[model samples]
Target: MSPAHAGRPGQAIQIGRDYYEGPLHICDSVTSLLAHYLDLLDRGAYEVGEGDDYIGFVADPYESGFDPELLSGGIPHDVPSGLQAVLIQVNAPRSPLDLTPLAAAHLRRLDLKRRPVTDLTPIRDLPIESLAVSLHDGDLAPLEGHRHLSSLDLATNTTIDLTPLRTAPNLHGLDLSQATVQDLTVLADFPHLRYLALTASQWASLLDENKVPPALAAARLSKRDASRTEALSWAARLGLTVGASFVISGTLTSDSETGRTQ
Candidate 1:
């Protein structure tokens, strides 16, 4: 059976049969969507909607024969121009995935959560507003001139040098949890930053009265061995919300101010 439904706001056009039962079939929803788009491309039907739509698929590149390069070549010839986003889940490593053919001007958002992408030079010149990718041992110099970037997630990367982010003037939110970034001073460059998440290595810098930026309103950190009293005291002094998992508005209660998790 094929999945049938109209695309909605903030929802992606999921094109896979993982949600279905029984063995994996070739003529599943993913294949159907791919075939439909391929047919449109072949017929030169270049008019589609501009309703913030996206297509997500999980398949092997070689076996599925769904080359991502087609997005920059044949797919864009028929599909709507300026497609919102595309999330490709590949089974193999980064060696097999090539994004050189994708045009960044038409793509605004991209999500490559766990993909082993070490080099970001390909999509660096594109106008991406939001991005989420794995940066383990990855170089961030390519992202320096991306002024339109507002949200970024580098939580899984370690020993990352965030000095390049100083050029990104519009960055508002950043995630660096589970990473080993020691310099909290680099964050001062982000004037519009409101939310930040850090690992145990970097969160301790917030304990210093002057280290936490005044523009920050919330922060997430691991409080396992931290002095909860001092951390909360500084957070209250800075008028910021701090937590282990998720940060929310409001100051810590007075009752739990004695080195205890509130």
Candidate 2:
């Protein structure tokens, strides 16, 4: 009933039927999320808990094995007061989620999985260390004040400019695998950025231009069909000098210009 927290990246802990890692890998299934929360509550997991800082809530009528009775009144709006991270995903038509209520000095991470939000203004002042979100309007203007953000994983349905994040001094890791960045050239301005994940085309452009951020220590190219040869070549050109992995191995000519993964 008591699950220890995995404090570092790439580590995982088991909670009920789910595996808990960092904020992003919180319970994914709706049924499992509810069961884990209830079980944790009964075990007093919320009392100065370790990994209980991360919680996930989901309410999707179409989700497999979903039962309405488990959340009769709809998704709970309130979260544990001392919670440090939260993941909320609701598959239904509704207004943007209001984050003002969730803002707290103790909160550090948040994952609003594909849920539209009013804006980033509510949490700008909060000491957020990491964020994973989907921007409906692709506006990053509200991110200027987040000086403590160390990681950001963005999902966009459309192309977006990365210029707004240039001012964040503490940003060390960025994930744009699910986004279409208008200008990856802006990444050069981030002196602290050490890890980056981008589409194949984006990485290729960086290689071609010889503009890979000098501070980068690791990178991930998001292309499903890209051959191991192509990826290794790309990394070599970009001065990555690291081993690369592929989901599915296939031959790819240097002329391949595919950008989007999906």
Candidate 3:
């Protein structure tokens, strides 16, 4: 748990099996249980700070200390300025969500988890550079002219089309660990892509078709299985650095080693 989630009887932050108990009140929410998250923006609690990647918020009562009334009240309508990077994890039923309110100029990174956003038209004009979102099997067509989108991470339970994403001129990194695609040839459309990640099964299908993206600098596989050896061999043949991540006792761990294959 992050420092913000541990609210007190005995305040403790867990770090690699060690717990540090202290007086820390980082919960930015006004109420002990979340009435809404817009209050955090008003209080200037949404900023991720100078060098931090992002400031995260958990909307699931089971996952965090507070209850996010997202079911009763939808996501905040407006994301205030100066909030560069923000990640909100939600637990709710599948429903349409409007993302136009989050299209702030200074907001470079936005991550929405478990969101049932079916349309991307609302965020078509966002100036965000990085986006990690749950697609609800959403189409990537709305991002056609998104020039600043350098990185995109998608979470979907079904296969999605990658043809729409090829329009991004600066797209360098893509994560499709939770998604699948029938046509691996579309990956060649991304001319500037350097990093790619996919599930072991997806990689196998690509390898069998001989359609791995040629310009990739690195690749990561989502699961560990017999297919990993073939992936490593494929990466080696392409002189690319490869890695894999898997769950070990409910803890996420990686077995990635640095340096490119000769």
lDDT of 2 by residue, 146-262 (tens): 677889999877788888788988889999998878888878888889999988888877767667777998888888898879877877777656574547767655534665343
lDDT of 3 by residue, 1-262 (tens): 3322113343232233332311222234335335445556566555565679776543333232222332232556655543444456556646766777656534556666556677878667766677887787677888886888889988865677888888888899999886666576788767789999887667768777667776888788767674757756756645566666454565555656854442
**What is candidate 2's TM-score against the reference?**
0.63
Q: Name the TM-score of candidate 3.
A: 0.59
RMSD (Å) of each candidate, 1 decimal? 13.8, 12.3, 12.7
Task: Report clash pairs, candidate 2.
Answer: none
Candidate 1 vs. true structure, TM-score: 0.54
The candidates, ranked best first by TM-score, are 2, 3, 1
lDDT per model, in order?
A: 0.58, 0.66, 0.64
Clashing pairs in 1: none
Off by over 4 Å in 3: 1-74, 224-262
**Estimated TM-score for each candidate:** 0.54, 0.63, 0.59
Error of 2 at 253 (Å): 38
Candidate 2 Cα deviation (angstroms), residue 130: 1.4
Report how far residue 69 has shifted in candidate 2, in Å: 14
Select the stronger candidate by TM-score from 1 and 3: 3
**Candidate 3 weakest lDDT stretch, 10 residues:** 17-26
Error of 3 at 39 (Å): 17
